[model samples]
Target chain A: MIVFEDVSHDYGGGPLFRDVSVRLEQGSFHFLTGPSGAGKSTFLKLCYGELLPSSGKVTLLNRDLREMTRDQLAETRERIGVVHQDCQFLDHLTVEQNVGLPLTATDRPLRESDVSDLLGWVGLGARADALPPTLSGGERQRAALARAIIGAPNVLLADEPTGNLDWEMSQRLMMLLIELNRMGTAVLIATHDLNLIRFAKAQVQARVMRISGRKLQLAGAEL
Target chain B: MSARAISSLVVPGRGQSVWLVTLSSAAMAFLAVFALALSVTSARLAATWSDALAQTATVRISAPPEEMDSQTALVLDVLRTTPGIAEARVMVPEEQAALLEAWLGPDLPLDALPLPRLIELTETAEGPDRQGLRLRLAAEAPAAVYDDHTRWRRPLVQAATRLQSFALVSLVLIGAVTAAMIALAASAALSSNGQVIRVLRLVGARDRFIALAFVRRISRRALYGSAAGTAVAMLALLALPQAGSAVPVLAGLGFQGWTWALPLTIPPLTAILAWAASMATAFRVLRGVT
Candidate 1:
């Protein structure tokens, strides 16, 4: 679980967002929607302890982010999965290798069968040995999703997960996220695509929060 | 994949930095071998000179031809009474001629000239007091001079000791340069592979895991490179002309007996240095990231 209490962040010029108080509970599904350059990605970064809030506290998994050591932060990250819009991957690694990285990085035994099944679930079974550079955009995103969930993190934070995908691929990726949420993993996705939000909202009980006027605002039922 | 395999895959394997570390380690290791050889050889030379000259002294009797034999006899008598003098013998004309043969060619005639008589003395472990013996020789044979070879031994030993120290300092400098090169290579590798690091970090990998990815690969390369360099240097040393009394010190620059095993340690030491250098660079670079 991630809780930001009255957090305000700035980058010298002015605050990107102010007084943003929010809590992402277990098994909850949420969408962070705002215009481009509206601090959605910054919110996701703050949730994962990658960036510190200028004012106020951000607690991750019941511990204050400011007090955690580097190793402790890394340990905490093992329980929080993240997917980026660009689908960051070690291009030299094969798809299956990248997917198994979470387990391997943590010194856990990597089950080949589990990795294979996860690849199958993500529709990347045929491309398990294929390198990331050789994969299509949609395949890359799906592989990224597989990698993020391989360790069974408690919360999933995604920044513009479907920003580069086609509508059909976007829906497909959303369905994957929904399926993951149904299995009890909390998911918070940041995006500017309203149709994707409505599509996901109809499928799961997802609340929509927007960043506007340098503050966090909960969008009403009209969203 | 195994943890090691996964770690290796996390970083791109080909880059200028890889070759930089390998080649620098190899070059530095090669120089280190020669430096080690120089150190060992000089140390041996120092000990040999000290031991060989410490227990011997020579008495030279410079007098008119009529009194040369009597003065030499008097010097011998003084040496006989010396407590630590084990053996004292007047050198035969042929032996004296042989000693001077290198400086004065073999064709030179010696019987017509008034050559000084020489008496070589071998001392016991507890040698006689040099000052007391010299005073006795000065009294009994006014033309007799006692020479302990201290003037020659002191300078030769000092030169060898200084050479050994120089070699040791060279080895230390070589190690430092090798470490610096490896660290620079590691920093370049980390900088060039920023994307890989970001991806690894995003996937919940700890700094240790990420650092191991680079450190293992770099250190292994260093080990291989230094091993090759050490092997080549040893082979080159073996191909040198065999050391002998006639050979110059430079020509005889190599290990002796068990000292040959010293250069073998260079490769592993280089690997350890590479590991430490790259690990430090990795952690420092990572600190700037998150």
Candidate 2:
């Protein structure tokens, strides 16, 4: 679980949030909605220990994020999966190799069959040997999702996971997220797509929160 | 760290920078192997000079033409009675001329030069008491001077000692230069692989894990380069001209007996040095990042 209490973050321009507080509980699905430059990505970064709150404390895994060392932050991140808008794969490595990188870092043994099954799940089984640069926009997103969940993390945070996808491709990615959520992984998707949020609401019970005037507000039944 | 641990995370596919690192490491290791060989040779030469020349002495008798033969005979008598003198022999004009042939040519000019006669003395393992021998020489053969070879040989010994020191210093400097090159190359490698590092960090790689990926790549390449360099150096050493009895100057220029294995240690040492360089560079780059 990640909790931000009165968190304010300034990126040299000024404070983006005056007093923002949010708590994400276990087994919960959340969609962070806001316009461009609404600090949606920054919120995900805070949850994964990439950024620190400017004035308040952000707690990760029941511990204050500010008190954690860099190494401790890395350890905490092992239990949290993160996906960026651009699938940041090692461009030189193959698809399957990129997916199994986290396991190498954690000293976990990688079984060949397990990796093949995971790639098959993401529909990247045939393209496992293809490099990231060779993949399409939708394929790249799917690969990023596979890499994120390969470590069996407790929480999943995707920042605009379908930002560059089409209607059909975006729906396919959304289905994968929902499936992972069903398997007991907390899911958080930050995006500006109200249609995707609406589709998610139809598929499962989800909490929609939007940033309005540097504050967090829960959305009603209608977007 | 083992090879399987890295699992080719930072393999040669990154860029041409890996090639540059390999070439640079090979070149440095080649130079280092030569420096090590030179250092060992100098130490051996210095030891040979000291041990062989220390127990020998020379006696120069510059007497009047009339007393020359008598003083030579007296010096030999005194040398024979001395407790530590193992053997003493007066050198005939022919033997002395042969010794000086390099400077004075093989022509017939010995009769014209008023050259003093020389007596070569071989001392026992315990060596002669120089002060006691000198006192005996003063009493029996006042015109004969007991030259223990120290006055002339000390300077040569000193030169060899200085040469050994210089070679050792050269080896250290070469090592430092090698380390600097590897460190710079490592920094470049890290810069080229920045995206890989970022992705690894995003997936929760500790700094050590991220660094190990690069370290293993760089160190493996270094080992390859060093092994090649050492093999070439060993072949070169073995192919060197052997020193026969006619060429005493070349006698101590190379490794003798078990010392031949000393230069073989260079490749492994170079590998260790390269590992150190990579570790240093990896830590520096890791520190600069998140």
Candidates' TM-scores? 0.96, 0.94
How does candidate 2 score on lDDT?
0.81
Model 1 segments more than 4 A misplaced: A164-172, B245-249
Please provide TM-scores computed only on chain A for all of the candidate models, following their numbering: 0.95, 0.95
For residues A57-122, what per-residue lDDT tens digits would candidate 2 score against the true structure? 899988899898768877888889988988798877788878887777767777767778989977
> Candidate 2, residues B1-290: lDDT per residue as tens digits?
12245446544454666777677777766776677777777777677778788888889999889999999999988888889999998889889889889886888588888889999989999988899989989999999898887766678778877877887888788788877877887888888878777887788888777777777778778778877877787677676655574556555466678877876776677678878898889888977766
DockQ of each: 0.76, 0.53
Write the residue-wise lDDT of candidate 1 on B116-172 in tens digits. Answer: 888899999999999999899888999999999999999999999999999999999
Q: What lDDT would each prediction earn against the true structure?
A: 0.90, 0.81
Native contacts retained by candidate 1: 0.71
In angstroms and one decimal each, the interface RMSD of every candidate reads 1.0, 3.1
In candidate 1, what are the lDDT values of residues A127-158, reduced to their tens digit? 99999999988888888888888888899998
Model 2 CA deviation exceeding 4 Å by range = A166-169, B1-6, B11-16, B238-240, B245-252
